[model samples]
Each structure stands twice: as C-alpha cells, then as structure tokens.
Target chain A: MQIAILSGKGGAGKTLVAVNLVNLINLSTYIDCDVEEPNGKLYFSSEYNKKDINVLVPKINYKKCTHCNKCVDFCRYNALIDFLGKVKLLPSLCHSCGGCKLVCEFDAITEVKEPIGYIYQGDYKYHQIYGGELKIGKESGIEIISQLISKADKEKINIIDCPPGNGCSVMESIEQADYCILVSEPTIFGLENLKLVHELTTLYNKNIGLIINKANDYNNIIEDFAKTKDISIIGYIPFDKELAKLNSNQQLVSDNNKFKPYFIKIIEQIKQEVDL
Target chain B: MIIALPTKESGEKAFVSENLGRANYFYLYDTKTKEGKSFKNNFLNELHGAGVKTAEFLLKYSTDILITPRIGEKALEILLETDINIYKSTEKIARENINDFLNDNLEKLY
Candidate 1:
C-alpha cells in the first residue's frame, strides 16, 4: 500500500512525521517528492545512484514555417512568440504538453529532449529510499515526481513524503496513493490550509487521515475541524523540546527508545486503517 | 511612428499603468495622424507570461515604442529581441508621457 504524507502549510512537520514513520515501519520504500527542496535524504545516510530525467520540448523548423501563429496561440504557457517571420521560443515556459507540436500544420515543430531534473535511488537499512531533485531553472517538478514514483517497487509499502501546499506537485504525489495522511499544526492557519488539502482529497476521492503535529493547547482548533470533516486522527507528535532537538540533530525518533512507541503507535493505527 | 502606452482605462483620460504586463489597456498614438485609440489588453488576466503575450499582442500594431512605469524581466527579454523600443514614463497620465516622448524628454527604459 502507498501512503502519502502531505501538509497544506510549510514547516508543519510533514518531514518529521514521514521520516519517523518510515523508520518505524517493517520494510518500506520512502520517496521524497519535494524535488525543489527534499529533506528526507538529510536524515537517511546512504550512497545514492543518481539518474537524470528529461522531457520533450518543442523546437520549430523555420524552413517549413508559415508564421500562421498556430503554435504560439496554442501554447497556453505563452512560450512561443512570432516576430514577423522570426519565431521565438522561451523553452523554460514550456510545460512539455506537446500542444504546440500538435497545432503545427506544416510539420514545423518537433520535440527535443531537455533535462529537467534528477532521481536518486539508494537504501537505508532494510528500507529503500528515493528522491527527486528538480534542475535549478525548471519550474515544475511534476515530471520528476512521476518518474520517481514509477520507479518505486510496488511489492513493498511506499511512504511518499509529498511537497507542501495543495498544488499540482502535491496532487501528483497523492494520485497513486492508497491512503493520504494530512499533517497539520495547532494554529488557525493550519486548519484553514488543512481544509484545502482535505477538500482536494475529497475531490480525488482518496482514503484520508489526519495527524495533528506539535500538539498543545492550541490543537483544539485542528481537532474540531477534523471532527467536523470526519477525518480520522492517526496520531499526534507532541510539541516536545526533546523530540524537536533529536529530530533537528538528524536522530530518528524510531531509533530512540524514548520516542519509538509514538511512531510505532502511528504505524499500528495506519495498519488498522488501511488493513496493512 | 506608432507610440504605445500601457494604460489604466480607455480614452485620453487613461492613466499610465505602473505595471507593463497586466495593464488594462494599450493606448496607441499614431505620430503621423496625431490620433490615439485604446484597446483592451486581453492578456491582463493571464496567470503567467502576461508580459510576453501582451508584447506579442502589440506586435500587430507595429508599435515603434512602448511607454511604461516598469517592465518585468520576461517581457523585457521578448521586447529586446523585437524592434519595439521601451521608454520610461515620468507621469501617471498617458497624455503627459506621450507629450514627453514627442518632446524628447522621456528616457529609454534601461
């Protein structure tokens, strides 16, 4: 089963939960889908084999071009432009949707491979680790995340650490998951954004659960919202200073006897929720 | 020479837009005819690349120069490749900038 860990707001402890959960689980594949700034690899010390990911972007053949502006008009990204007979392309803006190539009537456009990001594969103990790193100039890591997930072994349990926010990348990460764990904070900001991601999961019709991170007196808002939305509470990681210090020092809660039970309980609850 | 100003509204009372990409209207003033007109900028609401699309839209008018308070990097990239020269607008009113351009007072956008 694939479980996606996501949060609407940044710095809401999604990574903390994901790393701890992966370490506690029997044997699992952990995929860091936050290509722009993947932090999962920081906790897992391993020798990773890196691979490049490429996407096809359109290149115009000016000889056969009629300057009809069909490709320019078809590109919703506005990557294409025409100056009299000179056609200009801003390759970075291209989403590799191939609409421009399909719209060209004179066979003036052809696709060329462009490197967009990189995928890292490795192992930490009994678990497999995968990460996607988007190239510096690229905007969307959607393709990188897709390619990384495609490489995940379906035979084992997959723990996907999704990027923050309910945007395209987050949607892509959850699309293949059997269950989604929406992480939240105790603040009103967290509840509002949690509602956004919950609404998204509802829209996609996925099995959803919530984990209230940094639990304290302020958590009443998050609990009430979850209760109203009928979202199951998997488990809460207390806003304890020791846990934060250990986590900040790259120590896994699963490895420390003091905090192992917290994550173990979360795994047991997830197992029951998804029949794992 | 056909001069263009990124404007806030239609007609002579239209003020120059502070932004080049999401301007509400493009006011074109033909130097030979001493006549001006405003056309709605349909790319004003574009989520991204508004400047590039707006620049492409202005190409049809054969605009010799553009007057704006500021231009973004992406828009400036496309404009640099074209024959359209960008001029910095000193005033909020579109007519004042046009008069400045006619009197050689407005400076080229750096």
Candidate 2:
C-alpha cells in the first residue's frame, strides 16, 4: 500500500510522522515528495545518491529570429513576452509546452534541458528512502515529485512524505496514494489547516486518517474537530521532553519500541484500510 | 504613476518585494499617485536562475521605484543603476490596502 503523510500547512509534524511510520513499517520504501525542503533524509541519516533532474525550457536564437509575436501568442504560460519588437523568454515560467518552438515561423525558438533539482536515494538500515531537493528558487516541484513517484518501487510498501500546503506539489503526491496520513497539532492554525487538507483529500478521493502530534492542552479541540469531521483518530503522540531531547539528538522515534508501537498501530490501520 | 511589485505569480497581489527580507510576494507602491501594480514572475523559478531575462523584462514596468523585503546585492546594484528607488516592504498586499499605500499610509499596513 502507498501512504502519503500530508499537512495543509508547514511545521505540522508531517516529516516526523512520516519518518516514524517508515521505522514502524520496517521494510517499506520511503519517498519524500517535499522537494522544496527535504528533511526526511536528515532523520534517517541515509546515504545520499544524487540524480540531477532537468526540464525543457525555451531558448530563443536572436540571429535567426524574426521579431514576430508568434511565439509569444502561442505561449499559454505568459513565459514569452514581446516588447518594443523584441522577443524575450522567461525560462522559469515556461512549462515547456513546445508550442513556442512549433509556432516559431523563423525557427527562432528551441527547447533545451535545464537542471531543476536532484533526487537522492539511500537506505535506513532495513528500509529504503528516496527524496528530492528542488534547486533553490525553482517552481517545478510538482514535476519533480511526479518523477519521484514514477520511480517509486510499488512492490514494496511505500510511505511518502508530501510537501506542506494544498498546492500542486501536495496534490501530485496524494493523487496515487492508497491511503493518506494527515498530521497536525492541537493549535487553532493546525486545526484550520487540518480541515483544509481534509477538504483536499476528499477532493482527491483518498482515504485519510489523522495523527495529532504534541497532544497537550489542545487535545480536546483536536478530538472535537476529528469527531465533527467523522475522521478516524489513528494515533496521538504526546508532548514528551524525552522525545524532544531525542529529536535534538537526531534520533528516530522508532529507535525505541515503546514509542514505535503508536506508529505500528497507525501502519496496521493503513494496511487494513488499503487491504494490503 | 506606475509602480512594480514582485509577486509569486503574475495577476496576484504582491506579498513580498525584492527589498523585503523574505515574503510570499513583493509590491511596488506609488505614494504620489494611487497606483499599485504587481510584477508577475515566479520567484521560486527565478531563484533557480532560470528566468533572469524575464525578471529584467518585468523591471521595465517600474516607473519611479520598487519596494521589496531584501534584495540580493547584485539585483540591488542593477536596480540602483536604473534610477529606481528600492525601498524595503514589511507587509502583505490586499486590493484595498494597495490604495492606502499609494496615499502614503504604508506605515499603517505594517
């Protein structure tokens, strides 16, 4: 079964939940779809295998170009701009639809591959993890994530750490997930974002369960919200100083079996829901 | 008066500008005239050094000056040479709040 750990906003313990769940599952393959700020490898201390991923961008040759606005008119992303009879290309905004090159009457535009990010593959003892790091200031996160998912080993149980927020990256990660684990805290912002993620999950028709991290004074509110939404409460990890200290020391929660049991139960619930 | 603000995407409100330290979008506000316009270029894409020419294209819209959170020294020097005032911004943009910015009430937004 493929499970995606997601949150509506950042800093909601999605990474924490994902790492712990991978530890609980033991043999599962992990994919970190949060290319913008991939921290999954940090907790696992996995070896890195970097693979450069590139995207096709439009390249204009001024020498052979007529200053016609054909390419600009063909570009739907507004990546091509024509000003004062000069043609300019914005490679970042270009989705590489290839329409510009196809429409260039003078053959002024060509497509070129530009490196956008790198994917790192490594192992955490018994488990395999693959994560990507987006080149700073790059916007092709969804594309990079799709590439990661395509390379995912479907035979092994998979746990995906999805990017925060309900943007294209999150959507792409959750699209093919067999089950989803939404992690959130008990704070007001957490609750609001939890609901937003829930809405997105519902839109994607993905089975979802909730994990309330740092269950402290806000447990009641989180529980109430879960009950109201008719969502199942899979597990809760209390706010413990020991866990914080261990986290500071870069220790995985699954390092201790006692703490690992919670994620084990969550994993079992996911297995049952997906019939794996 | 036309002013340019760097935005996450074009046609969206400027959340952070190049002068702003780190924000979602940037807005260029013209105080003398009540005109607020956002420059559409994906900042994340620009960060990858992909659309530098596109950014330069948007820079043409700046009639007088620009307001950002924090700009790189290189971009700062380039804008400086163009005779555009680069001021730092500390607030997000909304449709209504932009008019107040043009009327010299930018301090209230922050």
Candidate 3:
C-alpha cells in the first residue's frame, strides 16, 4: 500500500515521522516529495544516485513568417505578448500547454525541453528510496515531484514524505496514495493546519490517520479534534530531549530506542488499515 | 503606485534589491503622491520557475520602483533596464516609512 505523510504547514515534523516510519515498516520504498527542501535523505545518510529531469517550454520560430497574434491570444498564462505587430515569447510564464502551438496557423511554435530538477535514488539498508531536488531559482516543484513518484519502484510498499503546505506540491504528492498520515504538533496552529490537511484528504477521498508529535499539554485538544472528525489517532511521540539531540547530530529517530515503539505502533496500525 | 515586495509569506517587508542581504519582502512604494502599495511575491519560487530570462507575471502590474531586501544579479539587471527605480532599504514596512525617509524620520536602515 502507498502511504503519504503530509502536513499543511512547514517544519511540522513530517519528515521526522516519515523517516521513522520507513525504518519501522517491514520493507517499503521511500520517496521525498518536498523537492524544494528534501531533508528525508539526511536521516538515512544514504548515497543517492542522481538523475536530471526536464520540462518542455514553448519555442517560437520567427522564420515561419506569419506574425499573426493568434498565438498570443491563445496563451492563457500571458506567455506570449504581441506589441507593435511583433510577438514576444516569454518562456518562463509558459506552462507548455501547447495552446499557442495548436493555434498558430504557421508552424511557428514548438516545445523544447528545459532542465528543471534532479531525482536522487538510493537505499536505506533494506528500503529503496527516492527524493527530488529542484534547482535553485527553479519553479515547477510539483512537476519534479510527480516525475520522481512515477519513477518509484512500485513492487515495494511506498512511503512518501510530502512537501509542506496545502499547495500544488502537497497535492501532487498524495494524488493517488492508498493512505495518508497527517503529522502535526499539539499547538493551536498545528490543529488548524491539520484540519486544512484533513479537508484536503477528504477531497481526495483518501483514508487518513493522525500522528501527534510533541504530545504534551495539548493531548486533550488533539484527542477531541480526532474524535469529532472520526479520524484515528494512530500514535503519539512525547517531547523527548534525547530525540532532539540525536536529530541535531544528524541521527535518525530509529537510532533511538526511546522513539522506536511509537514508530512501530504507527506501522502496525497502518498495516492493519491497509491489510498489508 | 504599484510596488513589489519580495516576501517569504504573503505580506511582510519591502526590501530594496541593491542593498541588504536577506529581506522578507521586496516592497515597491510610490513616493510621488503618498500612495503606497506592495506586491508580495514568493521570490525563490519565482526565480526558480522563470530562471530570470523573462519578467512575465512579475512585470505585469505597473510599478515605478522595486524595493527589495536583496535581488540576485539577473533579476536586478532585468528590472533595472525596464526603467524602474530599484531602491535598497532594510525597513520592513517601507510604505509607512516613505514619509520618514522624505522627512528624515527614518534613516537608511541598510
């Protein structure tokens, strides 16, 4: 079964939950969908095999001779600007929708591939792992993520560490996943953002469970929220200083026995839900 | 006037491109008639998506100046040639402080 770990906001310990879950599961393929800032690879210290991926952008051939404004008018992204009877092509704004190419009577427009980001594949002892990294100053993070997930070895069970926020990246990561684990803190902002993520999951019609990180004084609030939403509280990890210290030293949560039980419990719950 | 604010979030500081290192927002404030508006954009995402070759969505709105914390060489060069005044300031809310700079109520923060 494919499981997607996500949070509506950043720095909400999604990666922490993802890495630990991967280590606890019997065997699973791991994917880091946060192309902008993929820190999941840091947990396993796995050597990644890098591969570049490209996105197609529109290229105009001026030699085709017709200076008709049809191409400009057809572009919804304002990628084509017609000024003084001259057409200017803005490749960046181009979503490569092929509308301009399709509209141009004279075959003046064609698609050209542009480098966007890289996908890194590696192994964490038993699990095959893949993550994506968007080139600095590059857009289309969701595109990179989609490509990376497509390349995931489907033969094995998958765990996707989703990008933060309820934007395009998060949507692409969990698009077709079998289940979703919404990792959140116990604060008010955490609950609010978790609700946003829950709403998104409901929209996708995906089964979801919650993992409350830093479980402390806010347990009652979290439990109440879970009960009202009918979302299962899979597991909770207490605020542990040793876990924080290990993380600061670049150690995985699985390396600490104190945190292993929480991960194991979540893994067991996921297996039961998915009937794995 | 329409001003550009390079922001980490939606609303924040208006940074000047020529000065400062890291600014939350690159705000574009109009000094002519005491009317100020900020254009908040995700600078990292914009730069990543467009690669500084073209100013499509960025230059769509009308603006006289682009106040940013720090703009890369490519974006700065492109915006400078477009006849836009690029100012550098550390002040977060430059619209409120335009009068301060004019009246000497605020010194150049950067």
Top-lDDT candidate index: 1
Each candidate structure's TM-score, on Cα atoms with residue i matched to residue i, is: 0.89, 0.73, 0.74
Docking class of 3: incorrect
* Model 2 C-alpha lDDT per residue in residues A1-276, reported as the tens digit of each score: 688999887877888888877787758888999998887888887568899988888888999988888887667665676643567665556777789899988988888998888888898888988989888756577778988898667787788899988988888998888889899999998888998999999898888889998889878788898898888988888888888778666679767866777777777777667765
Worst 10 residues of 1 chain B by lDDT: B73-82
Q: Against the true structure, what is every candidate's RMSD?
A: 2.7, 8.3, 7.8
| lDDT score for residue A85 of model 2 | 55
TM-score for the first chain in candidate 2 comes to 0.93
Give every collision pair in model 1: none
* Candidate 1 structure quality by residue, lDDT tens digits, A63-174: 9988898988888888888765577888778888999889889999999999998999999999999998998767799999999788767777889999998899999999
DockQ scores of all models, one per candidate = 0.58, 0.08, 0.08
True-vs-predicted CA distance for residue B81, candidate 1, Å: 1.9
Instruction: Give the residue spans of candidate 3 off by over 4 A.
Output: A82-86, B1-110
Worst lDDT 10-window in candidate 1 chain A? A82-91
Q: What is the clash tally of candidate 2?
A: 16
Better of 2 and 3 by TM-score: 3
